[model samples]
Target: MNETKAATASTPGTHAHTGMTTRHDTWWLAPLLVATGFTLFIVYATFRAFENNYYEIGSIISPFYSPKIDLPGWPFSPAILILWMPAGFRATCYYYRKAYYRAYFLTPPACGVSVWGSKSYTGERAFPFVLQNLHRYFFYLAVLVLTILWYDVFKSMLEPSFHFDLVTLIMTVNCVLLSGYTFGCHAYRHLAGGGLNCFSTNESTKQRFKVWEFVTKLNEHHMAWAWFSLFSVGFTDFYIRQVCAGVFPNPVFF
Candidate 1:
């Protein structure tokens, strides 16, 4: 009886470890690193922009920084920060709770620390694990914001005399980066989750759900998209800085 119990327990443990290894061993880590690096770079760039006396977004009355473009208000900076927050958090979704509880919270694992440091058992306030909940809300916001940014791009294009400068090119690249990031959101996968019966028990929802499921399969791999999107954002900002400093021309893509 004792021997049988030991064998059964060990079998499941082995399988669990194997599954984790398989998931983490894929090309996932590379993209994750890339995304993390990009996210850091963008944060640094934004800080630099403020430090370089370009923080104001078209408030002519303020004696702080002069306005470059006629921006509405303090909209630009806040929007950028808000939009990137989800991207930043989502990047760590793979094993975030474990990292937090281990690194800061100093919680112990039920089974043992897997890999470097992870508790086998989750804590009482499992609510944070509900980080999963942010996916859908962020998805809608990301999509909406991307559409608005694209509109800004169109507005930029309208001015024929506006120099096809590097700053403008960077803005265009930023749009693309945002789109990729938004499309790759986890909630997007849920939104794409097939087999819905909320509206009607017919094929309409089913068919759409099927399409969403395919997209979700791609979105299911959130870590990859997260990193890819991060890199693109950093590159976009870099391009913007180069243009702003007169280092490059913003050539329009044909």
Candidate 2:
């Protein structure tokens, strides 16, 4: 019975290795890994912001505004960051993937008559590219965030009690960074274009349209601000995090 069992096990296609599955062969691995990296960077920035007590609005030494908010505390290891990276928002990568696939991959190889594997005579514009819609929403959010951050800067400058220090300097820089990010966003560019055809119909609207035209010229380099603002945001958040962590000194330039 033992010999027969051994022979059966040794037979071709009869036995399979039961090892752990690896992520190596997965098609989604690249995008998944990129998403994970983004999450970690944001989380680290959040942790540093909390450490510096960035959430505290009124005073330097006070606790953060949100009692429920929790970011991993430091002398934090990278392993902890990596493990926590997959916690949420698996859908974000789809946005990034689709945007890039069109901008970089799909558009390049497309041919005039060839229609990119689609049916002949079908119009792509009829479907109206959905990913482009995100630029508008992101633009509005950028403007909102920039306004808030700038308000914080103004508020800080207005405070007589704070005195001139590192916190104030950082806040000022943060405001500038946020503006760069907001102005650089793709949607902001569109708005700057004076392309709101319906908005231009009125005599009064024409005056505002001229201003938008002027600003749109600056906004035309959408990609420039996109990258600059992206990095600046990370830097601003990093500075705030450092202030929270007590690892860095908070400056207040009054």
Q: Which candidate comes out best when scored by TM-score? A: 1
Question: For candidate 1, lDDT tens digit of each residue in 99-133?
Answer: 33333333321123222233354433367655555
- Give candidates' CA RMSD values in order: 8.1, 14.7
The residue pairs in collision within model 1 are: 109-119, 165-250, 166-250
Query: What do the candidate models score in CA lDDT, each in turn?
Result: 0.47, 0.44
Q: Residue 63 CA error for candidate 2 (Å)?
A: 16
Alpha-carbon runs more than 4 Å astray in model 1: 1-39, 42-120, 123-132, 160-174, 194-203, 220-222, 252-254
TM-score per prediction, in order, is 0.56, 0.49
lDDT of 2 by residue, 1-254 (tens): 24453333333332222111221244344444444555665676556443543445443311112122345664543323322222121112223434344333332111111112222322223444444444555455445445655666656556656465666666566556546545544444455544566656787677666756655664565444444444555665555556666677765434
Model 2 segments beyond 4 Å from truth? 1-99, 102-134, 160-162, 184-203, 251-254
